[model samples]
Target chain A: MTLSPEQIIKLGDLAKLAVTEQEASTLAVQVDDVLKYIGRVNELETADSIGQWKDTVVNTNVWRADEVRAINEAERNELLASFPSREDDFAKTAPVFKR
Target chain B: MRANLTIEEVQNGLRAKEFSAVELTQWYQRQIKEKNPHLNAYLTLNEEALATASLVDKKISAGAKIGPLSGIPMAIKDVIVTQGIRTTAGSKILENYIPPYDATVVDKIKKQAGIILGKVNCDEFAMGSSNENSAFGPTRNSIAPDRVPGGSSGGSAVAVAADLCTYSLGTDTGGSVRQPAAFCGVVGLKPTYGRCSRYGLIAMASSFDQPGVLAKTVKDAAIVLESIAGPDRLDSSAKDKPLKKWAAEIDQDVRGMRVALPKQFLEEGLNTEVEKSVRLAAEKLTRAGAKVELVDWPLLEMALAIYYIIMPAEVSANLARFDGIRYGMTVGAEDLWSHYQQTRGQLLGPEVKRRILTGTYVLSAGYYDAYYKKADLAKKRMRQLFAQQWQKYQAVLSPTTPTTAFKIGEKTTDPMAMYLSDVYTVVANIIGAPGISVPGGTDSQKLPIGWQLMSAPWREDQMLRLAAVLEKE
Candidate 1:
C-alpha cells in the first residue's frame, strides 16, 4: 500500500487539484495507512452475493420549461468579484498542462 | 401572543386578527437582534422582511387566500444560495459572495409567504460536526452558552430553540441538520434524499446532501417541511414525491405504529444520559399506544466508516468548483494552478482542507476500487438492512448523537473525534431515508440531547405523525 510522490502528483493532476510538496508527502503516508486499515474489505466472502449492492434507483436528465432572462450587470459582477483572478470578464488563465 | 404556538396556530392567529404579519415579523426581528449576539446565530438580517410582511397584511385585509406560512419568520442557513444576498456557507472564500439565484428551498419558502428573517451561520463548506469550524465563530447552544451549538447547522437549530425565528433552514449531509438540532434542543428533519432540490443550495456530497429544516417543535418542523418538500427539476436527483398532506395527518393516533430500536446503537460510546432519555421517549410513545421492539441491524455499526469514505470522496469532487478562478474568495498568485491551490488552502478551514485531502486520496484512481468502491458496497449493505427493517417496523429509534453538545474546542484538533459526533445521524443518509431529531431532554450540564426517529423512504408523513403524537406530552 506504499505510495510514491509521482503517484500523488499524478492523482492531484487528474483530480484538477494543486497539491503542495508537504501535502503530497503527508497524503502519501496517510493514504498508505488508510489503505492498510480498510484492506480487509477486499477479502470479504460476499463475492457471490446477489442483490448485495445497487446503483441508485432514481432516474435523471429531465428537461425544464424554457425561459430567458437578464441579470443586472452590477449584481453579476458582485458574484464574480469574490474570485481571486479574472481577465476580460471571464475566469482566467493558466493552461491545465505544461506545454 | 402564544409563545410556543406552531405554524398552524400562527396562521390561525393571523386569520382571527390576534396578530398581524408585520407584528409577527417585527417581533421575530427584535428577538434576533436582542438574542443573536449571545447565540451568534445570524450572519445577516433581512431589511425587506417588513416589506414582505406588509404584503401579507394587505392580503389578510383584502380577504385574499393567504399562504400557509404567510408572514412566519424563518432563518436560512448561509450555505443556501439566496438571490441578492450574501451566501457565505460559513467560509471566508464566499464571505461576500452574492448568489444570482435563490436555492429551490428559498424559492419555495418565499412562495409560502415565509418571511425571511436572515441567514444563519454554519461549518465551513458543511464539513464539521461543531460550529467551531465556522469562519464567523462558533454558535452557542440556546440552552448552554458554554458548549457548542452542534453544527454545521448549529445556527439553524439554535435560532429555532432560542425562539429567535419560528423556524430555520439547514442542509444535512451526514447529520449536519439533525446532530445540531439535537444539541440545541430543537426539531430537525433531514428528508429523504432528493426529497428537496439542491438547485441553488451549494453541494457537499451531491449523493447525500439534502436541504432540511429546523424548528422549535415537531409540528413546526412539519410546517417548514411541507413548504419545501416536493419535486425540484433543477436538482436532477430530486425525487418527485408530492408534499404529503402532513398537517392533516398530524392528528392521526400512533396506536398501532411499529417502532424498532436497534440493540447495537446503545454500544460502548453512547452516553448514559442520552440512552436514558431516548429510552424514556420510546417508553412515552409505547405508553401512548404504540408497539416498540428491539431490532438487530449489524450493518449499523459500519455506517460511520462507510460515510467517512463516501462523503469525503464526494467532498473532494463537490468542492473542486471553489478555485479562485471562478466564484469565491481567491488569493492571487503568479499562475493559475498556484492561485487555485493558495486560495483554497488559505480560504478553507483546517477541517475542510483535511477532508479535501482525504477525499482526494480515496477517489484517486489507484485507490478508488479499494476504498471508495468498498465503502459504496458497505453503504448498499446498510441500505438493504434498513429496507428489511422498515418492512417490519414503521420507524427506527436511536440517539441522535452519542452525547450532548461538547465544549467548543473538545474535538477541534482531532478530525476522527469530530467525525464521531455524526455516528447516529449518517445512517439515514447512507440508506437514503428520512430521519428527524427531536429534543429528548437535557444532560447534567443542562445542554439539550436529541433522540432520532427514522422512517422508510417517502414516509415522512408517518414519521411526522408519530413525532406530533409524542410531542403532545
Candidate 2:
C-alpha cells in the first residue's frame, strides 16, 4: 500500500502537477497513509462484491436535441474574460509542441 | 433557545412592519462587519445586498405581496456560484474568477427575493475536514474562537451560528455541512442527492456533493430546501421527484415512527460524553412515542474508506477542467505540459494535490480494478445494507461526528485523523440518503454535540420529522 517516490512522481505527471521534491516526498508519506486506510475496503466480503449486484451509481444517459441555443451575453463575456490569453474569441494557450 | 431569526419569524416581523427589509439587511451587515474580522465567516460582502433589500422595502411600501425569502439575508457557501460575483471555492486557482451564471440553488433563492449576504469561506475546493485548509484563511468556530469550526462548510455554519445571516447555503460531500453545523450548534440538512441542482456548484465530488442548508431551525432548513430542491434540465441527475410542504408538514407527531441507533457508532472513536449525549437524544425520541432500537450495521465502519476512493476519483476528473487554458490563475511555460503542471501546482493547495495524486494512483492503468472497483463494490453493499435497514426502520441515528470540534492546530498535520472526523457522516452520501444534524447536548468542555438521523433515498420527510422531535427537547 505504500507509494514509492517514483510512483508519486509518475502520479504527479499523470495528474499534470509539478510537485517540488519536498512536496513529492511529503505526498509519498501522506498518500501512503491514505492508501493503507482505504485498503480496508478489501474487508468487504468478496462474495457480496459487484459480481453479484450491478453498480447502481450509474445513471441512465441523458439524451437531448442537438441544437444550439443563444448563450446569455453576460455569461459569454464573463467566460471570455477569464481567459489568461485571448485572441478574438479563442482562449489562447501556449504552443503544444517545440517544433 | 434559538437566537437567530427563523424564516417564519423574519416573515412575520416584516409583515408586522416592526422592521423594514432595509433595516434587517443593515442589521446583518453590521453583525458581519463586527464579527467577521475574527470569525472569517464571510469571504466576500455582496455589494448589491442593500440594493436588493431596498427593492423589497419599496415593494412592501407599495403593498405588494412579497416572496417567502423576501428581505431575509443569506450567506452562500463560496462553492455555490453566484452570478456577477466571485465564487472562489476557497481556492487560489479560482481566486479572481467570477461565475458567469448562478447555481440553480442561488437562482431559486434570488427568484424568491432572498437577500444575498455574499459568499462564505470554506476549505480549499471543499477538500479538507477542517476549514484550516482554506486558501484565504481558516474560519474559527463562533462558539469557541480558539477551536476549529467543522468543515469544509465551516463558514456557512459559522454565519448562521453567529447570526451574521439568518441562514446560509452549504454543500455536503462527506460531512461538510452537518459536521460544521454540529460544531457551531445549528441545524444542517443535506437533502437527497440529486435533490438540489448541481449546475453551477464548483465540483468537488460530483457524485457526493449536494448543496445543503444551515439554519437556526429544521423548519428554516425546510424553507430553504423548498425554495431550492427540484429537478433541473441543466443537470439530468436531478431527476424529477415530488417536492413537499416540508416546512408545513415537519410538525406531525412521531407516534409510531421507527428509528435505529447503529451499535457501532458508539463503540469506539466516539467520545464518551458525545456518546452519552447521543444515547440520551435517542431516549428523548423514544419518549416522544417513537420506537428506538439498537441495530447492527458493520459496513458503516468502512464508509470513509469508500468515500476517500470515490470522492477523489471524481475530484481528479472534475478538477481537470481547471487548466490554465480556460480560466483562473495561470503560469506561463514554453510547453503545454509544463504550462498545465506549473499552473495547477502553483495555484492549487497541498490537500488538493494530495487528493488528485491519490485519485490518479488509484485510477491508474493497473490499479483501477483493485482500488476503484473494490470501493465501488463496498458502496454497493452499503446501499444494499441501507435498503434492508429501511425495511424495518424509518430512520438511522448516530452522533454527527466522533467528538466535539478539536483545537484548530491539533490535527492539521495528520490527513488520516482529519478524514476520520467524517466517519459517521459519509454513509449518507455513499447511499444517497437524506440526512440531518440537530443540536444534541454539549460535551463537558461545552462544545456542542450533534445528533444525526438518516433515512432511505428521497425520504427526507421521515428524517426531518425525526429531527423535529430531537429539536423539541
Best by TM-score: 2
lDDT of 1 at B332: 60
User: Which regions of candidate 2 are displaced past 4 Å?
Assistant: A48-51, A55-58, A72-75, B1-3
DockQ leader? 2
Q: Write candidate 2's Cα lDDT for B327-435 as tens digits.
A: 7888999988899999999999999999999898889889898789888888887888888889989999999999999999999888999999999999999999998
**Model 2: colliding residue pairs:** none
List, in the given order, the native-contact fraction of each candidate. Answer: 0.36, 0.83
The CA lDDT at B39 in model 1 is 88
* Local accuracy by lDDT, each model: 0.81, 0.90
Q: Write the per-residue lDDT of candidate 1 for residues A1-99, one digit (tens) a residue.
A: 587766666666655556677767766765555445445555544564445455533335668788776879886787566545677677675666545
Candidate topping lDDT:
2
lDDT score of residue B369 within candidate 1: 77
